[model samples]
Target: MNWLNLEHLLLDESPDRLLCQDPDLTLGQLRRQALCAAAGLQARGIRHLAIHLEDAGELAIALLAAWRAGVSVLLPADLQAETRERWNPQVDLWLSEQPGDTRLGQLYDAEPLPAARLDLDQCSLSLCTSGSSGEPKRIDKRLRQLDNEVRGLEQLWGAELGNACMIGSVAAQHIYGLLFRVLWPLCAGRQWVRRQLPFPEDLQRASLDYPAFAWVASPALLKRMGDNLDWPALSKVRRVFSSGGALPADAALSLQQRLGQWPCEIFGSSETGGIAWRQGETLWQAFAGVQLTQDAEGALQVCSPYLAPGHAEQTADAARFEADGRFELLGRLDRIVKLEEKRISLPSLEQALVNHAWISEARLGVVRENRAYLGALVVLSESGLHALRNLGRRALTETLRKHLSNHCEALALPRRWRLLRQLPLSDQGKLPQALVETLLAAPRGKAPEVLEHKVQDDGLQIELQVPPDLACFTGHFPRTPVLPGVTQVDWALELGQRLLELPPRFAGMEVLKFQQLVRPGDRLTLTLRFDAARSKLHFAYHNQHQAPCSSGRIVLQDSATETAHA
Candidate 1:
């Protein structure tokens, strides 16, 4: 099951076949370069070498050369200086295409070196997780496991690849790109275009060179292609594959409409490798060797002998089975929300918001304690914003609030709404949760001033004042008498601090659920306790009932006062 053995078999048939983007290194020339690199490594007494390369044809050649030299290969995540410095291996020397330099890149022809035999069962390549949340960790795949992948892929698509050249956007250093662009092509006896397809320009260049090609790329790349480029119908392209992230339904349909064929969407992670592929609206058909089942929680569980043992990895993804024997992936099961004793799906909320005429994209997230507050960040289309500008900001917010209020209760309406210039799009158009938090951290415009009250030094006394004419009550529940929670809190806090110079800043309380709704006639008393050392203030609200209705702790700050004094 040695992958090299399969590669050798393929190479034997086309020693002169092209494997790189470079027109100079024809198939025969690349093989000769690999031999030379092998000899170079042997002469230097090197048994192990790590390759820091972009996804390209030279990288494949260098990898094959390392195998031919009987040297272990390490592929780092990126070529940061620190990454290069951390290349600790069993061997002391390194093999690179950068001749005078030590960096590993696509190879050029060199004199042939002695051939070193490889152990098919041994480790062949090392990959690292993306580590978006933590440090990247390395995972080693055996030559045999990789061989199984190439064999599986060849059996499924080898005939199509026979005449098509490999072309992909993802870097070969990652698992998806490596297997699709290198191993599969070599195993299938297919020629590969040698270069990482980076920009639209690069893809255009490749189209000029290789009329017939197979593109392997991520959903991010495809989404961007839809947004920015008007791609020609890929008449010469045999197939294209997409992976790395969820393929948006709209993006998939639009891409097919433009390209004349839909790219295959792959569902799997690095831990499990390729699992299944979905095209158009079809349910995902499992790859040839992969088996799928469900756990007790109804999550998709994959059992692959080729995967690392000790556990049958069950994914958080929800799925459904079709009578046709295919499986369809639903969204993640972890995205459920419970509010006001009613369970809600954020995705459903987002769908509802985006259904509005003005909104282009939307996401809803719960932020307050006990998930009491739900906030929305919306990206408005140009026409949407223009329409809103005519109504003014306050009118826009009020309009949206009233719109939601009509269908949902006051609590269900987003506590705060902002018109964002753009959606927090990832390299792909998908909104990441982390970026949502960043948007929420920005300062909201301002809370409108309601009423002011003054209290004495003891913090035990209070003064109550009402606005001569209430502006908030103008339309708020016109038929019913009600006070806005925001205005109510502002009035209560202003009056409680009059005499008690207990720090210019005070706390606000929202913990008490309003069991009985407060109306315009309700007289409310609010009290506070300030602890100097802790720089903390606690507030308690009292109305008709003796026991306080709500209490909360707030951290008080005087940075503005100190700055003024300075």
Candidate 2:
């Protein structure tokens, strides 16, 4: 098989063919801009550069320019201040599109330069991976490896998707987004969107303009799409690809029902390029020229042209090969933990919880409390929320425990629980284990003081004294600290459920207004009224002088169906 240098491959394409949307630039224009940028970078004597631009179009141009300048490219996972700080000492220059930063747009006036002849072994690209423990792991790849994968992608899907423009909901920084949204399209001569389609509404609107387009997205964005979308407009979508995490079967089925096609799910990591893909319920099929085998520990091992030549990469995932040469993935071997001398699979437990009718998503982790205990963070389904509202936290927790008791061992059940509106995902669309542990950490300072309590027919009334060392007040504001609005609302509902008869699940809120700010050492009165007939909870916070601090009416639903209807 013949391989082409990155610059040559990009410049060899048709000059007048469209390569990007949003501003709509042709291949010839992109080549000229990249060549000019290459001249600018070469003039600066920058041999190593970090590329963290947000625009896909700018990123492609910058990448080609850096390659032409013989500058090694380091792709940081994010442009956050801390991430940049960590990578600053290693790179010679920082390139970004953010305001006030060093931008490629400045190089537009420079003279176009010749493309560099980069050796396959000499050209290096650095990619970052968030490892199992949430630490960043840097992986270096040769240009040849990327060339092999892009060629494989074109060979597999090029004919079916002939000339389809690429649109993505994922960022171009990560490996998946980098390949599907940027590299594959660049090599295949297909136009791609410059900006990421962050919302379902954006996808619907873009579908109208580009009738033949392929969407590269993640499971997180696809699963949360509400029913209020314009399904008819989405019918124009030719293909959809999902990666970054497991796509729930129900979510895939729902997308197929609305969009007339199932999303093809790709499974791989930063260290290993594209490994396998599957359309719907079928077993994962390895990509062309990719070979899969089991290691001594039964973990999946991949040997492919896409990887470093003559070496195999071991994956954390456990899998079993089917008779038909496909593979079925078991949970990650590293995610299994021991609890009270019993080995428990965290993924299995989470899958069981998600199987419950009331649970939409679940994440399980082991937290330290004298000894290690299981903790769960869950997003409730409509029915689950209804159960929470009517039964309270204790009842809802117990109900879930009871449901798990039928299938899971006693020690495997989660000891603590937190109900959230949605799972906290990092910018890369991954759940950071450290963030989950922080949610279960015990408060450091003294709890708030409850001065007075009274029971009413509709609700309850209480007086609370804000402690100077309240945990929520810490790091909330540096100079003039005031109680956060979210904290106030959370306290009202938590205290109401504990002291009075308030619902457990959060449904909806209306007329929420914050008039005055509460500070440390302030005495505030809280009033909560439950309207069972209307399924609404009215709450208000007032200062010692009876001036309103905040007020809201929260609506409760009996089932997810009811929530959807309302």
lDDT of 2 at 294: 89
Clashes of each: 14, 4
Model 1 Cα RMSD, Å?
16.6
Give the TM-score (vs. native) of candidate 1: 0.63
* Model 1, CA-based lDDT: 0.62
Instruction: Give candidate 1's error at residue 498 in angstroms.
Output: 51
10 residues in a row with least lDDT, candidate 2: 1-10
lDDT of 1 by residue, 336-389 (tens): 667878766666566566656666666676766555777788766545565453
Top-scoring candidate (TM-score): 2
> lDDT for each of the candidates?
0.62, 0.80
What is the TM-score of candidate 2? 0.77
